[model samples]
Target: MCTETALRRENGDRFCLSTAQAETLLTGAPWRRFLVIGDEVADGRGEPAEGYGHDGWADRVAASLRRIQPGLAYLNLGRKGRLAAEIRSRQLGRVLEFKPDLTALTCCGAELVRDPFDADSVEAEFDRVVAPLRDSGGDVLLVNWFDITRFSPRSSEETERLRIRLRELAERKQAVALRHGAIYVNLAEHPAAADRDVFGADGSAPTMRGHAIAAASVIQGLGAHLTGAGDACR
Candidate 1:
């Protein structure tokens, strides 16, 4: 079981989930296998957090699940620099083979950061990647980007444009979630994501503090399903 831990926010506010609380929060969750797939975000790529170990949000989430179930199976098929299409082509097959009941997906950022991004094509690829999971009765967790534009060293106008682009991506993600009945957590829109410190110095991946925020969101989103307050998956 997890000991007392603080998932901190940038504004001096901290969210703590102790061992008992974590156990309660995740007890009865029907997750025997947890699979994470996507790009850099999915890989939890970033600098080591100040106090937290050098793991991504998915690791933290898996750790919590282990504390509760002790035997939870977790695998991360995420790689840095992989675009959405590559993720769908390379990772999706192995993912289906895993027969995971719980899964996390994120990848479009590779396209989002590049010039000449085709929103519709990326969205289509994402749909293809997630639809099978949704149909296979897997509980899907869809995480979007953080507000990393705030960390951009570009000119103010360019930075604002990047923010706008992020907002567009968030909208598409929400639509996809609604279409697939998946739980969507848009860190780009989260209050804590507004803190530039949550991003790494590279302005692409998250810092350790950012990972904490992502993990907390995943747990909180699952609480309803885990506690039987919402839909339960097989």
Candidate 2:
């Protein structure tokens, strides 16, 4: 199911959108072009055994937006196993060329969870890509890294340490997003992130149902922004 709720900032301020406000945003001045860039999760990469049904969360968001504005242009630049820097190098230029009204950027998960994680480098690359899009007047949706430890069967010290590092990286990225006036979606705190059903065998990439949850989260985040709640980020 779609998880819709108010988002709280690190400073204790909360941002929310009422049902009527969300309805108004959906039906009023809807975005016409949607663009996505990131890794496998955003690419909707699942095991071949699972069989592909959905394209990914970005596509789901596009479908929902299309209902409000017909003939919406959609593009998905997500590639499996791509790191944040790689995404910035490959897809950033194309994103500018597309000039989308709305852009969803999901990066850094692949970098943060691996060995020799460099939080600063990842965040710098994120800003390099996102800053330009935001300057171009695109509504950027920045998705934070989720806690993959929740899906892990082991409870070792190493696992705990990795989780801590991931959280730190997420916080840094969220700060950058908010600083740039982007809509930040805190997937790490979402209840669905811990659900086994929401993930595939790899325990990282979201399943089809998981993508729906992600899509709903993005919509709710956008609704909050359109309704004036997200202005607090400024």
Candidate 3:
């Protein structure tokens, strides 16, 4: 069994879950095996960028879910600096092999920073990776890119353009997720995501604290979907 620790929210409220509550909440759910695929965020890239660490959001969520389902199997296939197309090409096949009951996809963050951004191509690749998982009867978590301008070191004009492109891509992704009944975790709309303190020195990968915020956001999105509170992201 896993333990719960206190995680602070943007409003300074603490989010904590008891073991019994976790078990109750996840009862009868089919999320025993969780798989994560995408870029640095899914890979658990921490500050200093030294190596993979257990401080990323995917790690945190896995730990929390273990309390509910002690037999939970979690696998993360996130690589630093991977574009959406690369994930679709390399990781999608491995993800299918895992046959995960729940999966989270967080790609395209690296692609948004590059020039000649092609929203159509990027989204199509994302769909290619996500559509199969959705069809497999597993719950998918689609995380949206936060507003890059908040931590971007680029010129104001460049950051603004990137932000616009990312937001557009996020919207399109959300639409697809909704169509497939996947839970969408909209970090762009989360208050904590805009806080520069939540990011690392590179202004891209998240710091330890930022990972906590992200994990909390994902859990909240899952709750919304499970409780029939409407679509997780709108």
Candidate 4:
């Protein structure tokens, strides 16, 4: 069994949990197997200028897991520029095949570019992607899509409007996760750790640092959830 360790959050509070705590809360009472799916943010698919690389959010989460539980295994199913509809169509099969104890899904900026103003379609895509995971008895965690439109100087105003749309999508996605009892993390709302440099030097994709920090945040948050003490309660 895993052990519980005390943890302190920035806002002031105490909590504790261990890998064992994660194990305890799981449905099958088995060891942890994590599968994370996201677009560029999850995969670290930036250009040459950005400091982050193949070591995207998935890698960060894996590293954290290794530190928390040496033997834990994780699989990152991140694809660059993957819209919710795209992931729903292509990645769901592989995700179900893995049979992970926990799965985290992230996307948003890409969707804004791809789907634009299609809110209903976006919601449908989320439903399609998440339903199967829940039906399979897997513990699902949804990471609300992060938006960088506000950070762009030229498109700040347009991006801010876009951010509103993205925020609405995030809220809808969170509602779905909550309705199904899945863990939900709204990275979009995390102002303290927002990706200031959301785009790279070439102005194409998310930077490596962006991916790493975002992924790390998820890992730490999940670790806290698993340990029962809110270890990464940033």
- Candidate 4 C-alpha error for residue 195, in Å: 6.4
Clashes of each: 0, 0, 0, 7
| Clashes by residue pair, model 4 | 2-20, 15-229, 16-229, 17-227, 18-227, 52-208, 224-231
lDDT of 4 by residue, 1-234 (tens): 112122122112112123343333432223367788878666656543232334565665555556555677788888877888878778888898888777788776666755447877877888887778888787777776455554555466776777678778877887777667676776666553344565565443566545544564565566556555442221
lDDT of 1 by residue, 115-180 (tens): 886777777887898799999998888888777777787789978877777777777777778788
Q: Rank order by TM-score, top first?
A: 1, 3, 2, 4
RMSD of 1: 3.3
After superposition, candidate 3 runs with Cα above 4 Å error: 1-28, 48-54
- What Cα-based lDDT does every candidate model obtain? 0.76, 0.71, 0.74, 0.61
RMSD to true structure for each model, in Å: 3.3, 7.0, 3.9, 7.0
lDDT of 1: 0.76
- Candidate 4 residue-wise lDDT at 81: 77
Highest lDDT against the true fold, candidate: 1
In lDDT terms, how accurate is model 4? 0.61
Relative to the true structure, candidate 1 reaches a TM of 0.88
The residue-level lDDT of candidate 3 at 194 comes to 65
Clashing pairs in model 3, backbone N/Cα/C closer than 3 A: none
Name the top TM-score candidate.
Answer: 1
Model 2, span 1-234: residue lDDT tens: 122332122112122223343345566646898999998777766533232234466776776687678789999998877998899999998999999988888866677568888888888888898899889888888887457777766568867887888788878878888879888888788876766867767676566656655666777878778777752254
